[model samples]
Target: MDEAKRVEEGLAGDGQTQLIKEDCQGDLHKKLDRNDGGDRVEDAPEQPMAETAEEQLQVVKQKSKRVATLDAFRGLTIVVMILVDDAGGAYARIDHSPWNGCTLADFVMPFFLFIVGVAIALALKKIPRIKDAIKKIVIRTLKLLFWGILLQGGYSHAPVDLSYGVDMKHIRWCGILQRIALVYFIVALIETLTAKRRPILLEPGHLSIFTAYRWQWMGGFIAFVIYMVTTYALYVPDWSFVAHDQDVPRRYAVKCGMRGHLGPACNAVSYIDRQVWGINHLYSMPVWQRLKACTLSSPNAGPFREDAPTWCLAPFEPEGLLSTISAILSGTIGIHYGHVLIHFKGHSERLKQWVSMGLCLLIIAIILHFTDAIPINKQLYSFSYVCFTAGAAGIVFSAFYIVIDVWGLRMPFLFLEWIGMNAMLVFVMAAQGIFAAFINGWYYKDPQNNLVYWIQKHIFINVWHSERLGTLLYVIFAEIVFWGVVSGVLHKLGIYWKL
Candidate 1:
């Protein structure tokens, strides 16, 4: 019986049977078929390791289509920026802040900075080699720095007063570009140096190597600490630009050779700025003077010195060296949150929900708080101002993400995306008198016969209750129309200008 079974098994060991066994267990088949007879059959080809990796990469690419939320958020921010900036004035509009607090207009800059930070986090993931990454960062940093200086040049052109005999030098060293350069360089360096650091506890666990650099909370902490300490130390009442009492102000005025009151020369910040930058070219007027004016205001209705105290000397200029720290902190915080959304996929939904609720509550709290103690002021970049503006920015970005990314909705207004793509070009055009020149042509004319003015009087004023609303709508319509033409050209030519 055993011999009959063995003969039957041997008969079953044909090429078809062996092929079936090999398909089930290739390793076992290889060992069984190592004989002369078995060697007659052909061996299957093995797949290369590189081919497997390529397939895995293709899978990742397909999965990454959902990250377009960042771009949509950026586009929304840019649109708001353009609208607020081009508005003739905030009067009778939902825009503009109340005294000493923020408005819809205040949220734009923080949103821009946050978008930049998000880009930084995404870029860190695509670097093929560390050396290449460092090189790219250096190149971008230099470009931003150069562009910042060029923008500063815009403010440096002395403001000529043909009517008045005053020949004041216009010092334009500190501005938007300068701030961008400072923030970009510092944030980029932080990202590069800490490239190999471990992920934070709050970060998402399912991220790929390309998405692991979202841990920017450390940068945020550093920026906040530096800004608070530096501003407090340099601008506090007793230690720096602020006055301790009336006696101190009087003593400083006496020392500066001014009569009873302190003039610009007697003001510590102005004097120092004039000394450092020279009287012929002091770019510190608006900011430093504004700060001085605020510090000297009387608690009750009474006379106060026009000039800042001697302590103000330390942080005398508008684009004062120290204030940049706070601006940078604001940017870092924005970037940190942006990176969190991009890298960690696990907590994003929860984060979105929390951010939405938090921002709504924060806006309410800020409005209440602004009623007393401090007013929301963008010029000062006050703590409450930062909180209020950032909260608004958060809400805006979150909404964009929900609609465009989560819900997979299309951007019907492609023009906004176009403007966003060429944001630098748009900004430069606005700053360099191009848009002003065009708008002035449309809006201004001799009283005898102006086209837009005539249209406004006959049509808009006749139809609308408030002419202001009509005028605003006209301005907004013109802006959108102009942007449509510019964006169309940009899209056709594939022109994108980034810093």
Candidate 2:
């Protein structure tokens, strides 16, 4: 999440700044030195060893060369992730689309991939040795995969469910962290492979940046082609799956002899997942169950409709193989933004590049979506979906840059900055329900009488007397704000959990 920064130092004719720097260095140096990665520098000398004013100014400049806006943007994404996951059940529009449209929750995964792309540009800007870069990428990839499988693989049932562990035959293979690992591996390797190639600096408006990062863009395009070809050209035959009703397994057949069908019944995305991961291993309770066609209770999960289609009972993974190919394009779009941050030093130039690219993407998305050529669907990870989300991501990121980096509005967003700095930790504890599980494990008397349940019931629900409003408020105050404060404390202690 690193980006280039400019530091403005105020030097007084009375030599007052130097005196302040000398006094502040003792405490500031310790705090700054403990910061992870690009956020920190070499420990400052206890005494001002610099004999000249120029040397002292260099020290100040070096200490302030990391981007604060990037952290704020990442933190904002984390907050949204918490909000959608915790409160989506109460508000259907905020939840992921049941089949073929975007919603608040659908944006989380792409936003993460977009941020990862920006991070890759900053992280591997200069890879001195290919072997070292490969080693680091592999290690981080393995770690993400491990955590993904552990957290989302049915290993720890939290909150409502006190039980933990899942049968190996039914463990889910793909999820948020797992998809991120795959995307990161591919995108990082591409950047590393092309790190040595120098870009020609043509005029800014003349597709110059595209020419510079053309190889990465080309790679993304190739992946998109593979996804499109498979989705349309590959035939999906009749398939049967076992549906357990009242603990009684019954095999039902679904008719799908089509080559190109984007419906819930048959699509290359779900087909590929079922063929590879097996039906038992896929996500049993997919978002499609919330569709009006399938659910007796529209926009929510409940009893199935009397004539609900057989496919409604089948399992599907949203982060399946074919869809992930389209997701790679999302990461590449992010890389383009990161490259803008790196090559362009001037604020206006950087913003101009970001806004222009963002608008172009949005325009393309609108055409595709309106024409029905590629409907915006998160389940399928449609081309229009990628364009729309990535385009929106670029615009949102630029706004944050303007607000936090340019306008110096840091005080208002300090909470987000803290969460952004320790994003992984918060993702595990809050979003994954690890912290909730732990507190629930220590409940008094009945398992339902946990601290989390009590607070949500007494403090939020009872006071408000509205299920939807109370649930939303609980997530906002108890989950998002509480985690923000925890992350802030961790940030103050100079603690960060990196990948």
Candidate 3:
């Protein structure tokens, strides 16, 4: 049958798996042949209509059995990424936290990683050959890294400058996509190493989920221990960095002859990044500079305060190497959720496992945060941050699964699904500022007169009369909604950008 007919047939089947039950198809056909009064139709259609319908239904259900919630979850993350990247300037609370607290923007990266784990579990459920898996994983990681470096490696001067070029000496070496590539590579390798030739679900036990993937958990724990030890035990010597004031650069000394410091100035996260990536290669415009110590008006970038600390002006990479090691834990936690989706066939069973795990993580995170043992710092990718964000991600994914997959309420979230399916495309175009930069290149009457500028100024700011609110609205409509529609149209055309 056609696509629409197949979707209908699939929907008419099981709500959770969206697959027709083979054994029940005969019963369904029998019921269909009977009249309303329970008497069989003596003269039914002789075209074998019931048999044809059953065959068509089975075909459709099998084709449509893939999970929809995963796409929706990924789409939700892309939307948030666009929102925070575009409009975070208008709202500080939604922006990246300056030093040691969680914000709306802080959860995006971890959420991405968590879902990556889930995707991994689902995708790698049946790997026929270990060699092929390794090849695919390496190739995918390389592609991700290539795009990450190309998109985020200071190549495009988006929104601000029409010119596009960067000095290789000062280009940033680490970013969101790069970190994702790293996480994916490491985690995928772990999954491959711990994978069984047969499905882990075949192993009989209530604790198969944990027992099956125990090695991956151990790997993650070992990584975490390494991070914790390096973070608290490593000695951070006094260092100096050059801070540019206007066009002039001045060297500033930061004293940190201590260990186990989580402060912005002396954290091991920053120290390792500076040493490995070099200070000049780190992210020039770090979120830490928005702190009160650096900005007289907190949470906004401006002229540095008169008494701002030395580290405030120094460069820092939020997606640095060591912090990424901690980030692996987030991926590991996500793998557990994905395993639940793979191992458990029943909706209630999956929900029970996910919700319990999510709550446990959230509770632990809250305790860590409240006790000040490990604050929820996104820059450091703190343990508490991983727990909190991963837990929230699990809960959120479960919600989407319930609403869209379990209830078959897919229409309302179809846009999200489209975007999620083509997330990398939308992310590169919108969140990475490539689209803005492209449109910005063709400006009228000087570089300031562009479609983006005009829309923000006239359509949003002019109508709203408030810069902050207008900017927020502009992002919600011009960026988020606009991309959602574009993704939907692309979905209609079967165009997806994947690595």
Candidate 2, superposed: residue stretches over 4 Å from native: 1-63, 200-205
Ranking by TM-score: 2, 3, 1
Error of 2 at 364 (Å): 1.3
Give lDDT tens digits, candidate 2, residues 1-499. Answer: 1222111100000112332244344344323221222222123444454544556445554554456776777888889999989899999889999988789998899988898888777666545567877887888788888998998988878657989998998999988888888888899889888877846244556578888888999989998999999999999999999985448889989999998898999898889988989988888889999998898787877899989998888888998888988899998998888777776766797899898888888999889988999999999999999999999999998898888777878899999888887788888889999889889998888999889898999999999999899999999999999999998888777666775
Candidate 1 residue-wise lDDT, 1-499, digit = tens: 0111111100010012222222223232222211111111122233232234334333222222324445445555656665665452424233433224455666666666666655555445223346755675676666655665554544323111111122334434555556566666677567767766735433434333224544455665666676555433432122223322345543232244332112233333344344456533434323232233445532211233545444333223434344455556555655555455533344464365438544864675476565654345554454555566666656666666566555667556456555555566666554333454443354344432445456555665556766677666655565555665696597577555554
lDDT string, candidate 3, 1-499, tens digits = 1222111000011011112333234344443211111101122333333446457455334333456777788888989988998889889889999988888899899988898887776565545567877897898787777877887888877757778788998888888888888888888898887666335344777677787788889879998998999999999999998875448888989999999999998999999998998888888788988988898878787788988887888888989999999999988988888777766767888899898888989999999999999998999999999899999998998898889878889999988877887788788888888888888888888888888899999999999999999999999999888999998888777666666
**Over 4 Å off, model 3:** 1-64, 197-199, 202-206
Q: Higher-lDDT candidate among 1 and 2? A: 2
User: After best superposition, candidate 1 residue 306: deviation in angstroms?
Assistant: 12
- Clash count, candidate 3: 0
For model 3, the run of ten residues with the poorest summed lDDT: 5-14
Would you give me the overall lDDT of model 1?
Answer: 0.46
Runs off by more than 4 Å, candidate 1: 1-66, 88-99, 155-169, 198-215, 235-320, 346-350, 353-376, 435-467
**Residue 202 of model 1, lDDT score:** 39
Residue 344 of model 3, lDDT score: 74
**What's the CA error at residue 93 for candidate 1, in Å?**
6.5
lDDT accuracy of residue 11 in candidate 2: 6
